[model samples]
Target: MASRRHPLATFFHLFFRVSAILTYLCCDWFSSSFVGCFVTVLLLLSLDFWSVKNVTGRVLAGLRWWNQIDEDGKSHWIFEARKVPASNMAATEAEARIFWLGLIICPMIWIVFFFSTLFSLKLKWLALVIAGISLQAANLYGYILCKMGGDGDISRVTSSFLPQTVFQTACPDDFQKPGLEGLEIHQH
Candidate 1:
């Protein structure tokens, strides 16, 4: 049986994502300055990006991703998944569901925000809207690669433009734990 899911990991998986959304939605009530609202939303988005990329996804869903540049100046996106073990993997069904749903849904919300902002001609808000969409969409794309065994091309044009390399990593003994796995995930 899988080890129990870490509640903290589940909490973090939702934390920044929710915080960023709420901050973007309610920033005007709290701060009147455009710069203040922009910076806060961006900071929350950055935190969401970092935490999702480096921490919660691995613990909750056994996935990690990064980009590598070859000596020739070409970029390769690498998506890695933890090898399935003889025993069940650490992620519980609920935890994995939470991770994936949160991963998938947030970007969709941002897309709705994008169109709403565009149609309203809220030109000043467009830059922040784009940033939110890009950051969330990147995670959604990376994790979907891991979930699908990392084989699918992101797109033919993207593949031709940037290239991609996918590999599976050995599941570390303490795969369910959070701290040291960050270093191992980046290892080729």
Candidate 2:
């Protein structure tokens, strides 16, 4: 199931992730200003986060995630996979594999960096390291949920606490919510 259509998204999916890693690994060689390196790495990470959550996952893996607030003002995390028909062009195996690999691997690298920074007592870099870990880990976790529930199981998971209209309005027509028939609304 390899796809050739999303080469550009695949490129950027890995580009920002790899760039952030390289920048962190060789920050000293690239610049003398701690602020410069810190800002640069954060920017790359932010781009990677946005691209993965909003663009690459949707294009390459048919996955998208977001947080929504219900009328009760409660927050809900929605993980969605695009509805694709059998005859449509599904994501290729290669691109999907690359998306998942990049999603999973980057956070592990940041975790290792976290411990290394802690052990070395480089507290100055701790904040930056934590930021990287948080951002990467968030995408990883959301995608995992999105993929796990790709078959519309998310409706089941979220329907208990949320109103049926929430999913309907939040996703509109792009996503598939197969099990919505069984949802029951609870009043506070």
Candidate 3:
């Protein structure tokens, strides 16, 4: 059986996504200053982005991405792919759904806000909302690519990455030593 996310992790994952929307709406009730409202929304949006990328993503989905500067000063993204068994694929899919759904929906809410402010000639608030939309969209793109690349299923890299000893131990019955006969283990 696949391990489930902690209750608190799940709560915060949903909370942060929803709070971003709620904060923007509620800011009006608290103050009339456009700058104050813009800053407040920006802070909440940042919190949502941070929580989704760092806490919820790692805890719920077992996925993470980071950029590293190599010795030659070239930057590259290093992704961590958690080894999940076939049985846990469904759970992983569910987590991915939540993550992607939030990514799609949050920016949409901001888009609506953006146009409303634009039409009203609220340039200051529009600027901040545009920034929020851009940040969310970038996050969405990165996560989608990461999910596609790091899906826990076996691929060309999996065979090369898994050592023969461990593979044999894990699949003793069907194990075939590499470079012997024409046997190849192809996982679907």
Candidate 4:
């Protein structure tokens, strides 16, 4: 069965995505906007939001599928030029190259960035490092918040989308609690 969309969650997702991009580009006043965007994207990417739960489920499912593979066989993947179509072979090769390159180069890229930051004596680079550290901290906070549920979010402090109505004041019944001593409610 498919999950029903929560109206509030949908609104926040759209708001966050657009806010993140704007935060990155709106550096006219404060340069910290870029840092905010970095944190937001990192959090959004890592968090298993409803939109991404399928992706997480697929990953877990894929791992389970892989475990079923027979590891005892002496096997090799031989791509026959005659059997496979040229376009498909080319596409497969391109995707394979990308996967292999990501596997090899991502760590190296991080290592290079690490050493460059570590050995650098420049003030500008140090500022960038500080921004990155702030982003990581924000991401960690976001993940913790996600785990705890979205009833409370630090984004509400920075976001303009938070509810600010005085309807509860006008309609007091919505805000009032019933007396538990005399209360007996139907459990439907």
Candidate 5:
């Protein structure tokens, strides 16, 4: 069977991905003022980050992340994974692939621009290039975490610096209560 995504998920996935590239080009190629272009690209990058992290990610792949502060003022990162198992997660997998692929490609484009500016000694564009790369890297990190089951368990560890938890309250297979075997209820 083929995997499929909701129409909106498909829309936003393409929108955010294409917008990132277009915004970068517009700021770099069309805008006359360096400061103005930098600010515009920064704003667009921020919008992409928020939309991907909050809206499209949840709608398409059912994943999200947030941070919490403890009494000691230490920060803990939490990743929430919807319990859609692999067997039944074909659609989610497809959506995740789109999200991840876009994230990967977007950063590469920025990296190219970064090098082009560096070699040409166009130091004015330095800040904008770095900021774009940083934002894309952050998005990539979240995508990786989502793929790793969001439990901070990418590998076995004997010790850890940060605390993590995986709450599995929404497993699709465990949603129903078991009853007497062979018992059935009928309604009129």
Candidate 6:
């Protein structure tokens, strides 16, 4: 069941890892929220890939995935996995762009929010909340940018998480979200 691992998750794990490390060299205050995103990305990378050989091992693997793996070890009891060609350069670049954006944007937003407190406590709460919300938006933009082919990945993740289809059904990317810099998921 080599199906559970998502390419995006693995990629993001590396990203968050590097970003967390860079938090020391590149910036200051590697805060709890930073750790939270790092941990979430790590958990995603630990998705149970079911490349088992024995029946017992297979069962154990399936059990680890909450019985998500099939007897044939295909699905691995995780979310639907799309097996894009390992050589898909375009998709790879698209994913990199999104991930890099998150790597850059997430920390910057957190840093600003982290320092917004010297002025006032209310600003601290406001900054942290705004930073968290921005992380969600950054995640959505990166995910959608990664998903931008065959009307599948970008639109699908966008619709699932920060879905704008309900409010801006007519917009191509539903890129009309009020607060976003630009809801347009600019594909690489």
Which runs of model 6 end up more than 4 angstroms from their true locations?
1-87, 122-188
lDDT of each: 0.73, 0.75, 0.63, 0.33, 0.63, 0.36
Which residue pairs come into collision in candidate 2? 1-92, 1-93, 2-92, 2-93, 3-92
TM-score of each: 0.75, 0.75, 0.68, 0.27, 0.70, 0.25
Error of 2 at 4 (Å): 1.7
Pairs with backbone N, CA or C atoms under 3 Å apart (clashes), candidate 4? none
The 10-residue segment of model 2 with minimum total lDDT is: 179-188
Candidate 5 local distance difference test against the native = 0.63
Tens-place lDDT per residue, model 2, 1-188, is: 43477789999999999999999999989789999999999999999999999999988877788878999999777766665444443444456657777887789899999999999998999999999999998887677667556334545643441333334334545544342222122221
lDDT of 1 by residue, 1-188 (tens): 44555888888789888988899889889988989999988998998898999998877777888888999998877777765443444445446657777876788888898999899998798899899999998887787665554555657533532221111122234234322222223322
Q: For this target, which candidate reaches the highest lDDT against the unseen true structure?
A: 2
> After best superposition, candidate 4 residue 44: deviation in angstroms?
7.2
Residue-by-residue lDDT tens digits, candidate 6, 1-188 = 13323364544434443443344233324455755544543333222111211111112111111224567776431211133344443333334333334433444555554556435564424433354445444433433443342133554555564444333323434343222121222212
Pick the winner on lDDT between candidates 2 and 6.
2
lDDT, candidate 3, equals 0.63
Q: Rank the candidates by lDDT, best first.
A: 2, 1, 5, 3, 6, 4
CA RMSD of each candidate after superposition: 8.1, 9.4, 11.2, 23.5, 10.8, 17.3
Clashes of each: 0, 5, 0, 0, 0, 6
